[model samples]
Target: MRNNRPMSFPRQQARTRRFTIGVPRAFQISPDGRRVAFLRGRDGEDAAACLWIRDVDSGAEHVVADPRTVGAGEEDLPAEERARRERLRETGAGIVSYTVDDAFARAVFTLSGRLYAVDLDGGAAPWEVPAAVAPVVDPAISPRGTAAAYVSGGALHVVGLDGGGDRVLAEPEGPGTSWGLAEFIAAEEMSRFRGLWWAPDGSAVLAARVDDAPVARWTIADPASPEAAAQTVAYPAAGTPNAEVRLAVLDLDGDGVAEPRWIDWDREALPYLARAGWTGPAAGGPAGGAGSGARQDVVFTAQSRDQRTLRLFRADPRTCEVREVLAETDGTWVEIMPGVPAFTASGDLVWIGRGGDREGARRVLLVGGREAGPPEGAYLRGVADVDGERVLYSASPAGCPGDVELWLFDAHRGTSTPVRVPPPSPGGDAADGTGEDAGGVLSGRMRGGTLIVQRRDMDTDGVRTVVLRAADGGEPDGGTAAAAGGIESLAQVPDLPRPRVRFWSAGERGIPAALVLPSWYDADSGVRLPVLMDPYGGPHAQRVMRSRSAYLTSQWFADQGFAVLIADGRGTPGISVEWEQAVRGDLAEPVLEDQVAALHDAGKRFGFLDPDRVAVRGWSFGGYLAALAVLRRPEVFHAAVAGAPVTDWHLYDTHYTERYLGTPQQHADDYTRSSALESWGTVNRPLMLIHGLADDNVVFAHTQRLSSALLAAGRSHTVLPLSGITHMASEETTAENLLLLQVEFLHRSLGGAAGVQEAPKGAGGV
Candidate 1:
């Protein structure tokens, strides 16, 4: 029953949010293993997400809560909620995220600033917690399931499930202070989304208090609407002071009253709050058993401003005493992997440690006075879940740099082995040449003996999720359950044409890359094609992966009569640690050199790329690389479309920029060399600068300054300013038309139907 219809790729891509609208995400498996809760939009074109639950036994699905039922429209988001979503890069609406109690009996979420709680076992409709304030954000039910806590109007509040005894737990003391919320840097750069964690006993909560008074303010205005007042934002640029963040434990009694006890830590030495959470009593301890009154352990991860040192601290919530458990140091910056510094039920501290006989490989280390890691060559990615004595994690297997697989490490058994998660069925409608079976990416959660695994590969169109009994054959007890069942995804099928991708490594550095050819391309014709080098060649972000959907845009560009090349040179993740850290202290040289090397090697092997007519296009970090290509190496790249590019490293944020280039005062030469602004005077190729005027992240000043410098140098360039777009082009029309405009520009500049034009002789003419 496939509905094949005619549709514009650009319009469909924009309307579907890059085909992510209907995907089921944020999966949570109940400890009892009875139900799995997730969020999904109504369909591919629907932007409003609804909460859904699947029965593990019968595989029956039910819609627990829908925004439409509550009469809340998608456009009524609070200012704080909007800002949070922006930082998360989330484009969906309606129950975008929700939190469940430890027992998974109840769930809490916010829609249009109204907090709603649902009883999972009772199957009752969600009821609003009558808040004195209208808008609330980040609501979470207490572990005890009797109360819910949320942030509203710069204050943290707790209310009972019966909608009674509503009281404020903490409030801001100054104009720029807020309780129970993550600051801009923490949310945007550090990847620590939540600002509060509830103790396992539900007797208390640990919350973050952020004070932004010391940060500098920047005004963002809409020039098209001159009469409107400009929006002011507290921005911490590189080398600027970040918001002061302090953690406090809030003791919540049965009556919904709370007393705050501030945790003592050296903010001057470790200013970056990487993570915080509570762990139960150590294994075999007096209070380790259920119903024990022994205080739960509070753990946190902190990093120095330079990011070279990261420390794990254990704090006493009662007396606020902090003690260091472990510390890791690196010559370059240390990466903060997600789901680490976690404690096993047996009291062992689980973490990712670097260099254990593998030279530069990151390995999962279990330490409880003693340290142990997985077999050599297993590059640990992140910790997924820690049940009793087993830790489920994702890692790149030995000799498979492009594949990520799930492995279970049992500290009690002292064995680490791959989990037998099912892979996608072979012989489907995979992207042209990529249908060959490669390892699928594994991600999921484990509770008790039940595991919820989501599998995706380059050959699959969408993700497949399954609930299964553990490998040890332990079945969860509770709820009309029989055996494990697969969760059916209601996501709409993308009707676009399938992409034809070829994955390979190029150059001596083994730079990973993917090449896409047009659907109508005929290799027998022996016609050389124009080359479009599309890359996000920077740290943390990878352009080349085993996922097929990751190349949809590149495939579309290829269909427009050009060969598309996406290279993941040094500085990208999912590779060895050495490759990721190769760009330290010098961002431009190695990255640009790797891109050029990939292009030449790819062209030499394929013999279909016309190097003389090459153009590059990218956004953000990729945009910076695109501009750098033409400005510094004009002879290699003839044209480029740079979108929201960071021309100067100084204009970027503190954590991300400083991690690579260090402080501007100390590494001034590195900043100058890494900045695209420094080489703008040498621009000798056709370049178009695209930027959103309202973007506060990279700011329009980057484009403005670059254009000014280009003009002063008597160089010709095109600048396109988007009036109201941010770092992301969320506007449907803008996102859709941008693709078409880029296609048209590339066609004209690279000798397509629009006719080719050569630059002036001194401008590095092709």
Candidate 2:
């Protein structure tokens, strides 16, 4: 019986969107580093975020705009906006994103598809631009703060802030074409969400025109509401054709009728436009400070359809001529690093590459075509931000996969130093890459000379955001500290018991693993607990992080009378590139091997773990792994719960699926060897499949096909279909019941007693 519990941890977690609503995020710092702009909700439970600015020295914050006060009272999101938010995993309601002008005079954002601009100086209320089309998207304020450019009805338009001079700069010429909008592949896989970028001087805009005529369309229909029309989406599945993307320059000073000068490139060889922007002397400088229109150069990166070759090019916007700046090719497909193709103040190219060759050369920071820093063995994640001559990056120190730390590279000083987090006690060094604070995660942004460091550690509950100045620490010139001043968070404190987690490296490979036992579990009780292996054993993500928040859900599961084990295995990131690439051409074996290896090693290490009653549960790639665990290695995992899993990789998208398996047309064996559908007939365990009927990312068909295959084999299983829900089960009722139902199923399948615990005292209900 799935009876609801008042003030339950699951309900509160869902209501507060995992306690992320009131956290200060989407930050932008002014040139002087004295003021910072951010987005946050008014209170812990407030869903709509309000725009705020913090006075660095005074430590005072004031709301610049509240969506409830300024908006149309309801959000009528466009399909494009909804899809963009889905891809971004943005759960907040109001002012999700905003762009500031070069001078930091005003900021532009879109609400309910209408455009709104507010002065950052706090003297005026935000006013909606009446000239814009009803449904505008991704409005960017010009560098000179004169006008804003936005996309509407598949066309690019510019509206003057002063004169209200609205004009259509570029329009779609065909049915499947759109201007200033990212293609599905770019947004879902490449992380390049926006298709238009402003030139440094704001006189011109570089926009992408996408034509999806060649792509195949898939239907997403509401089975429950058959009267609803089926929505068709362009899905470039593995081996299918992708949308054609091209770049063009649109001058804001023109009459809005002339044809845009298209950037020249060999599209046949490199069909994927990875990134695009303008680089100039005015980059990150004052409004229209130095670089002008004609002299500015547009830069972009492109990749081959197979994704093995990546090229960066510099283009002359005037002549539409392009020159290749650099090229990197790999036999196993190149990984796309974030915040790249950037530049230093001295006109040096700041890029992340394999240093030299794909073999042996580690992923390192490259400055002006040279291997810059991070020593040799550290795993360089990406260039966080480049301020003048200083480059901030995130990385996992050598031999420490669970710890993610930040390091700064000073081009002027030829030195690379770790950005330290202050010790918990006084008179100690900042959080360590491997020292006492070895289990922390750090992500921050740097602008001008100011740095914003957001940290989540095992010692803390949620995130702690600190603002540091040039003199306090993180000043590009010199000085570094744990933190200077902190931005307060209104996020709700978790109502669950503190997780009793122990971290360690498992096996000879030293896979990062964590064990979360119930707070009530006693070693001397003589009651051996069943083991639950939880893992996201895939690429580009890690499970065994040092953050306390990362394992809250896992801890909740552990409290249900089981020892939850989490692992970051071979295919997961934050480890070595070789470890991540181990699954190439065979995504099933290496990952599963690591998971099983970690489980057995953990079972042997922990005396009270009952290995015979082991179970596995996961979602997305983790879901795939959980089901794979039972189907392929039933002796190790007796029961499984897979939610929204990719049962057959052949149904997955191009950019992500093709990276490891290539085209299914070329490597059919890899798909068969990797997908859970290949081993469906071998199932001999209690298996449950859960999926959302309306999920676009991992569509419902994935579960349907696997269920059909299992039925064909006469294997018994359970399928729970969530109607009218997407990939994210954020609804309070659904999310809470999902937990309750999963725990009930595990107890019944494993023949264990129900172990639901009440909320801790003083923790109010949702």
Candidate 3:
């Protein structure tokens, strides 16, 4: 039930943005694996997200596109599709994403900022392309499904699909330039949310221009609209000036607006482009220059603005030359690996590097550069799809760094395996009906031999999906294998209770922890309870994972009676690349010493934990490690809430604060040993801080410069702000009264074991 009164787990995890609205997510299969597509919500309180498809031999699930049947009700989007759905933390709302045609016979997307498309073999009704251009950001669909490429108002258009060729190809040559979107350090720290790509014979696109007039602007305001005007933002932060980003190609088999061909490099020594596209003509390499043999080439990867050199070029879209096939250096940075500059439909070169040295490094993958599978000591994580010579990826094994799984690989049998799911028919409890065990946290896709997958564990609560394939000509039913099924999750769930977590490998560098408790805690009733921790604990992300929606809001803060814990420790990630470069130059002491060593090793192996009623909460680098665990361990955290925190690593963002503190102008003591305003007059506990007066990623000037350095060191705390929030307090009554005012200020600053009660004064900020 989406809610029928009596639904509090912070209002069903903020009306399910956390349980992720109706769960089926961006799948997209169809290269002859009989159609698949995805995106969900016709339930689980449906906050928009429609698209659908599914028919692998009559499993039928259609609904092609329905932003309320294309009238696009009340979405008025476009500040570049609301900053590309706030840089893809995409809190759903109608077709959150799409883009299909590589003969997946058509699909596009975008609703409020226009453009629609739709035709995956027609059951029609999705028109509005009218040659796009009404704010359409990040479209794509052009493997010759006759033209699409998007991004408006900062130009790079190319329309054509029966709206009579709308063409602008690349505009914005001044005022914070732009051309094909994605800037703000390549979509918030290099996950590279595309600037544009297209050419496997859609005759060319490549893109990315970005300028942001040498960044650093900031502002935001609307502190409850004093007649509202503020906004500004170019931002960059930490050793400032970033948004220059270049790259080019253009041509769309041209007749007008064509002239681009740029693609140079050494952009002041690799200023983070981090990945671009095209190897097409089915990945068979070599072209455009050096004999212009042309089987499709472009490929990209840039990085090093002290991201310790990532480089992987190959370019040549008709002699805008490039070359460097592989580089990867590191003394401390280079991590940008997700799906990689891939290829392998026999054109080899599928890359992801760094193997053992700086504190035993190891993340291999590569396919033509060799060392295939995520073998020897696993932990890889990222690659998740190549699909012709296979690949797939995702990792976390060498001693289960919290179970992420998925595997596949193949490149013509240099083997890899581990994909699972096919179990249910003998008893029918899980090809989706939730018997889980494709182990925890998987994800997938694949083509022709089908696959799909999905998963999430701690024995499932939301996400399941499945699919599989290969059983069409009547297979030997218990021998030749292949034939799973199941995709139906309408998400909801967390009408709380049933979390009682535990997971282990806690202290002495085994770190990975979990804890959670209070599903009516009675660990043999020793009754101690009152700790909380809940870290994001830094580096990319992972808050103790083996999924059950990652402990539904840490078991709704352990059913609100404390004892939560969580942790990943040493600079996070699936536990490698030297455990995410151990916060390279200290983003605050080994992440507040592994959340104070997993809260004193879970208060010495669960003796019902109270560790002096600790408390720590987070958001963004776990709200800078819950305000650095009460300004650097207030005798191991007596209280803190911190949401949107980055209490100044020089106000964040420069390819993630210069890949772990390097440019706060040449590591001003690693930004003063990771500034929680260099321990602002040691505010002894009960912190608070909440920020987000429109955060453009950790902005609100980092909780107004740590609440003006804790009121100029007179130290007391508690701030809140919020007006027009971002940095995902995904709204809904400020994510349900910021979890009921941080468990009523951790039970009024841990004075009484927060046995939770008082939570109604002005709720939580706007």
Candidate 4:
């Protein structure tokens, strides 16, 4: 239970970093199920995350490595590492991620650009890897556990676990060329974070070589620190030339030297390297072979620049031969999902496919493929793990868009069903054990017979994790009784008021929404409260979900005297393919229409919402939507706070923006129609634009251009420029005060009680 004490919501939100500072994540369950390793902060307020492992037998936890003890400071990150973390929106400190070997005996990670390895079985202190280069990034231990591969100085290097024979496997061929690293678009938009993948046998590696020479360069300078030189970045804006990405098969020998064999593919046609990985022996090729063995299959997925066609290919690393396995095409765009183009243990290809005649849902298809599950409303999100006979995945079933449940499909039995792992009750007992329903959004990973299940819902303050063993009857059997219990969460208790959330569907499209009323509000008092519509309302994200923590900020705003409504209409994920594609060709119209529809419908159902006093607030895509609401539909939205909004589609990236809006040259009108810059003249509300000057994703120029247009149109608006923030308002003081400022602005703009004092001196611009 949380401490029932008064605290500043904004301060707590900042201190705890939105309740994510100490949460355990990036879980890796050992194949033998004896141990589970994760990264978490030492305490809720602790920013530096440490690597910890839990013993499945005795339920004991061991701190494998602590940055504080290792003499590594989070502030010592390399420039490349800092940029990578920024792309990932990772704000935490210390060991944020690590990779283990196949046997789970060795784990390798880079802390402050120094490579370190820990002996999982020996309980020894982590030691630095002997590298020719001092700074390292993305250290991955080979599957056999004898060697590790990492990137340094834009080159890939490998070292033996015995601390000898460290050598550069691949070096840059040209000025802007780098090996074993994801390109900007691949990392920023495609969600394929890694640039290299190891072979199952550890004998070879499939690596990507990136050339950024053709991409346009943009300089970001710190205006406050005039003495520092500006940093230049390769930014591939819409319609601009992208980084040249290619894959190579690097064969390694015992001497730590690698010979690269370039894989042949039509780089001009399929330019985007969406995904690349190695599937185990089940993906058969040659039997009883050594180098390009029959057991290991090198697979990759590539998409055209327009993103309308995606092709999956399997390659022979020994010969650098490639064969297309599957190809998908759509007129609008083909979606690239995570954990797909995988092979089941028996050599069957597994992937997530768009809707077919059998069902109007995104489903798992086994290649030569047939739908693995029942053709219904179950929208497959991603594959978690694939064992010999079973595939584990996450999906949202019928009428449960807010809840994602773990499901398993037995390839042998041809049965797909939800995995019913018991959830922990408030008292920490099994929900079933206490005769209560375990209702929540569930996600899990399976290894051998062990399963690690994580559950989060509106009823809980934090995520609950449980480990279970599979029984012969195909049900969860409590493994070592003590170890089988819910894993103790070291996350800090957010001592904040519980959200009074009401989940419902609104509008004709059945847009999912959650309406949060003030805890002290009396429904029968006949007081119509002002409304605040908060929504991301875009593709790849959902604002309304089953997690309680997802509503914390919205609830805080509600407690500040407004009814907060979050909606996920068309273009938001977790519905059908059609729902997600609704915004294609024109990113603005349908999304804004859905938000408008959801607002009106929710106001009609929830009598306490005052439509005339409604305000909208958001960041990123939501920020764009907020600005759109006031500029184009001021009659519906009275005021807005748009933070880091995308003012023009041409300024965005190729992979993300081109997928929806097409090329600016080809579809000039579409970009013109979708951009907020074109509609600035219609603004008739108290609009405030907030942007971080250091943001590279949605650059500060977005806000600057919009503010300039508004000023030219003689429209009244405010622009708040954050001097040193990025896409994420991660700075503690800035994040806390930003929320307070938003509340103060809303209260003043919406005719409520004047709240906080004026904004800090230099925070505002015009």
What would the per-residue lDDT of candidate 2 be over residues 1-766, giving only the tens digit for each residue?
0112346678778888988878889888787677899999887788899999988777788999999989998988998898888888787899999988877788888899989899998999999886557688888888888888888889899898777678899999979999998899999899888888888877788899999999999998878999999889899999999999999999877586447999979999999999888775333322112233345788889999888899999899899889999898887778878888787777678888886455675788888777777766788888887777778888887777777888888888888877765544242212212223445888877767777878888887788786655443456432344344677778887777788899889998898999998766777878888988889889988988888898888877887788999988887888777777788899888899889989889988988899889999999999999989988898888899999999999889999999999999999999999989885435488999999988889999999998998888888889999988788877778988888888778888888832334323322211
Number of clashing pairs, model 1? 0
Comparing 1 and 3 on TM-score, the stronger one: 1
Best by lDDT: 2
Ranking by lDDT: 2, 4, 1, 3
**Ordered list by TM-score, greatest first:** 2, 4, 1, 3
Which residue pairs of candidate 1 clash? none
Alpha carbon lDDT of residue 559, candidate 1? Answer: 70
Relative to the true structure, candidate 1 reaches a TM of 0.92
Off by over 4 Å in 4: 1-6, 254-257, 281-294, 358-361, 425-438, 471-483, 680-683, 753-766
Candidate 4 residue 430 C-alpha distance from true site, Å = 4.4
User: Residues 439-478, candidate 3, lDDT per residue (tens digit)?
Assistant: 5887776766677777778765777777776455431111
Please say which candidate is ahead in TM-score: 2 or 3: 2
TM-score versus the correct structure, for each prediction: 0.92, 0.94, 0.33, 0.93
